[model samples]
Target: MAVAPSFKLPNVGPGPDPLSLSALAADNEFVLLLLQRDYHCGNCRKQVQVFADWYDEFHERNTEVVSIVPEPRERVRSWQEEYDLPYPLCADPEAAAGEEYDQPVRFGPLGRFSDLLGRMPKAVLLDCRDGDPTICYTHEGSSTWDRPELEEVFDAIDEQR
Candidate 1:
């Protein structure tokens, strides 16, 4: 059973420089979190686009969706504009939050590739109560292509209500 680690990662956004799942949530709110591999993954880009396309629906459910990327601030900021992401995006170049959330990483050949190349994409629904973050749903895989279905991700958000 994987658990969500309470973490506040620095983001590439303007006002909300640092975004934390716990802080973003209400007294008892569920946050839909999307963890991306990096700026390079095609699958990651597709998944993000999917989320962008359905951003309104997620909002209609009163669910807050956020994406975390292991890219530098400059690159992440550029990506934010490129995606025109309706949600928050945090930069984790050091992969600190990824390590805390137990986000997967490809080992063996893929792992040997490069620091920015070995990341494993993941998604999670976190229920933030008071100041603690609990994992309501978690999706971790060894390959970048391995991702949770949008339906399942939205379903997890619906569970909060």
Candidate 2:
């Protein structure tokens, strides 16, 4: 089992600024970390919206959804204006957190240079009650559109419970 990596980034959403992995874990039973492909990813936008629509349900289960975009804080701020997401939307311009969690990148060197060209989406569910946050489930996308369903995430959390 993989242990979840710790990170702290500026939040551009309806939540706190400078959100940290440890704090998120401490506050919730589970943390659903959504790693986006890039700033303009349509699928990423849709996925966040879906999670926003189902935010209440997730909260009822003591799970917090956090969407991370590997773009500048300003770029991520635009999303907050457009989507108005209810959860934490973090900005990780350097992609340090994404790299920490091993978010997949294709196209070799070119992909590393440009996130839009190579980065793929990823979903990580962390069990946070324990002292150390542990990765309970992960869906690594082979393509930009390849992401797990909301129910699938819920089921994963339920199984662990």
Candidate 3:
């Protein structure tokens, strides 16, 4: 397994103030990072809501769900206002954090110029029980709608345990 990329971002949260990957790893057995396409993506919005709805179950499993949107803090705050996610929601305006995890970018120059046009979705489940976070499961979406079912993630967690 690969070591999960570390990120320190401003959390528009119902959780931590400043979400630090290392700190999250220290606190939870698993950290599920949802790298979103952009703020406007419908699928991304729905996926986050699902995660939020299932937050209790994830918490019971010693997991923390962190959603990373490649947009400015202000844009990310809007998401918090709309959805009131029960987990950490962070902003990565520069896409620096997303790039670290190799979040997909297609459509050539268009994708680079506009995340909404090119960036796909990604779900990374990190095993953080150890000092360093290790990526135990990952689903790199080929299309905007592509995403792993929550059961797949739960099974991965169970296997890791």
Give the TM-scores of the predictions, in the order they appear: 0.85, 0.97, 0.97
Residue 48's lDDT within candidate 3 is: 96
| Regions of candidate 3 where Cα sits further than 4 Å from its true position | none
Tens-digit lDDT track for model 2 on 1-161? 67899999999986668999988988999999999999999999999999999999999999999999999999999999998999999999999999999999999999999999999999999998886899999999999889999889999989988
Q: List the residue pairs that clash in candidate 2.
A: none
Candidates 1 and 3: which is better by lDDT?
3
lDDT (Cα, tens digit) per residue for candidate 3, span 55-148? 9989999999999999999999999999999999999889888899988889999888999889999999999987899999889999999998
For model 1 the local lDDT of residue 17 reads 67
Worst 10 residues of 3 by lDDT: 13-22
Error of 3 at 48 (Å): 0.6
Ordered from best to worst lDDT, the candidate numbers read 2, 3, 1
Q: In model 1, where do residues sit more than 4 Å from their true spots?
A: 1-3, 108-116, 129-131
- The per-model lDDT (C-alpha) reads 0.75, 0.93, 0.92
